[model samples]
Each structure stands twice: as structure tokens, then as C-alpha cells.
Target: MDINMKKILLLGMGLSSVFLLSACSWIQPLPGAFNVALLEEKDVTGCTKLGTTTSSVLSHVGLYDRDTAAIKKDLILLAKNEAVNMRGDTIVAISPLQDGRMEFAIYDCVK
Candidate 1:
């Protein structure tokens, strides 16, 4: 392969890697994790507040930035799994996402 061809091949591989990483999420929901619902704070009235959860994920996979929607979704999934660990059935976002981190309040509204 010529020098130019080798450089192009390396560049193509790097771009492909970035694209794959950006398109995929490393976070996976645990079993029964999705059973926990995300609700608005006002809607959780009368529910017992169990505790708080902080979920974080990689906002950028290397030089490629992940999609904002995907980051938000992953954060929610992690928070839901955490609510399950707390024996809660619902979660409310307590703060805006910042630096790939978010906070949520866990509640048991079904009881």
C-alpha cells in the first residue's frame, strides 16, 4: 500500500470507531429496572420518598460526543435501576443533567 493509502485507511478506521462508539450505549438496564416509572414531582404526591439517586454516564465516547437524547435516556435507565434497588416504584428528576450526571428522587407510589 502507498503512503497515502495507508493514511486514508487509518483515518477511515478511526472514524468508524468513533461512529460505532457514539451510536452504542454501554449502559444496560437490569432486570425489572424498566418496571420503575419516571414521574413528575407533582404527580408523585402522597407517595413515600425513599431516597435519592445519582446517575452518571460518559457524555462523550473519545472525541465523539454522544447524542444528548441518548445520554438522557441512559441516565434515566440507570436511575430507574437504582430505584428498583431502593425498593421504589417511581422516580423524579431532582436536577438538570450536568457533565453527564443527574439526580433523581425515589418514591414508592404504589403502596
Candidate 2:
């Protein structure tokens, strides 16, 4: 009877030890302890196109530089004028090309 009792006690203790050790392992931090949850991506848009126009103020020998300056001023004025006309939400891209030409674009970025 004593032998049987000892055998049962040993089996119970072994089973409990196994369960306790398994539970203890789960208490420790995992390999990726610092892992963070991923965030959802957000939509974003920027300038995608450009438009340009040019006006010839004058064309004469030895005065090309002066004409070029005038053309640049006119293009700048035009761009400012167009920019003011934009209302609410607007995206704009501006660029200047050779020979007194200006380029820019504006588009609705939000849907």
C-alpha cells in the first residue's frame, strides 16, 4: 500500500512540475518583444504635371537680352495671376524653361 501511494504521489508531482514549467515559459517576453503593431497607409499626392506659355515682347538685333528680361517678367506676372485664381484646395507646380517660357500645374489633391 505504501509503495502504491508513493508511486501515485511521484506521478502527480511530475505532472504538476511539467505543467508549471510550461506555464512559466509563457510568462517571459517572446523573441520579438519590441514588436509594434503596423499602421494603415495613408494616401498622398503631389504635383504631377506642368503647363507653360510664352509671349514675345520684342525681337530686334542686339536687344535680345532686354526682350528676354521683359518676357520673364510677363511670365512671372502670368503665373502669379493664375495662382491667385486658384480657390479652395489646389496643388501647383511651376518651372521656367529656356527662351522666356514658364511652366506650372495645379490639381485637386484631395478626393
Candidate 3:
């Protein structure tokens, strides 16, 4: 009923809306574009091994927990980007690290 109480309620609603919207995927940073192939160690026989690449995803505070699928997707994209930078066509021996990171050996294949 009071003006002060109404203002406080409005401010609280505004803050709550901000927090809720911030948790949406649309508000998050866009995922990078890198479409490198994921291959096994034996599959890189004829491919020239470039080097190893590592990537990670950090957890953030949100109304809902971070999506593991999204995290893995981003990690894969990060690794592929690294492979692309290395002039590789595929990433071999891909492995997940204990620290929520991914490691892969980059390779350039002549197919």
C-alpha cells in the first residue's frame, strides 16, 4: 500500500527477472565454429600428427545447473578450433581429463 513498499517490491521483481533471464542459453556466449572430425588413435595412421590440444569449460552460478551436454559440446568445439588453427583435419586420441577438460591429438589427413 505504501510508496516505499511498492518501490521495494518493484526492485525485487526487476532483480529476479534479471537473474532468471541470465540463466537462459540465449544470454550465454555463442559457441565457436569449428567442425573437425573426432578420430581414434588407430585411425590416424596415414595422417600427419600435428600436436595436442586441450580445452575446458568453467561452471557458473545460475538458477539451473550448467548443462553437461552443452559443456561437452563447447569443449569439443574448442578442441576443433584448436585443431583448425593447427591446420589439422581431425582430432585423434580424444580423451576427457579429470578437471572437466578435453585433450586430443591433432592430425592432418590426406584423404
Which candidate has the highest TM-score of all? Answer: 1
TM-score of each: 0.89, 0.30, 0.62
In the order shown, what is each candidate's alpha-carbon RMSD? 1.5, 31.2, 5.1
2-106: candidate 2 lDDT, tens digit per residue: 999999999899867654443331122223322311111222244322232332322223322434554555444444344334421232324544654556453
45-93 per-residue lDDT for model 1 (tens digits): 9999999999999988887888888889999999999988889999999
For candidate 1, which ten residues in a row score worst on lDDT? 20-29
lDDT, ranked from best to worst: 1, 3, 2
lDDT of 1: 0.91
* Regions of candidate 1 where Cα sits further than 4 Å from its true position: none
Clashing pairs for predicted structure model 3, backbone only = none
Worst 10 residues of 2 by lDDT: 35-44
The lDDT leader among the candidates is 1
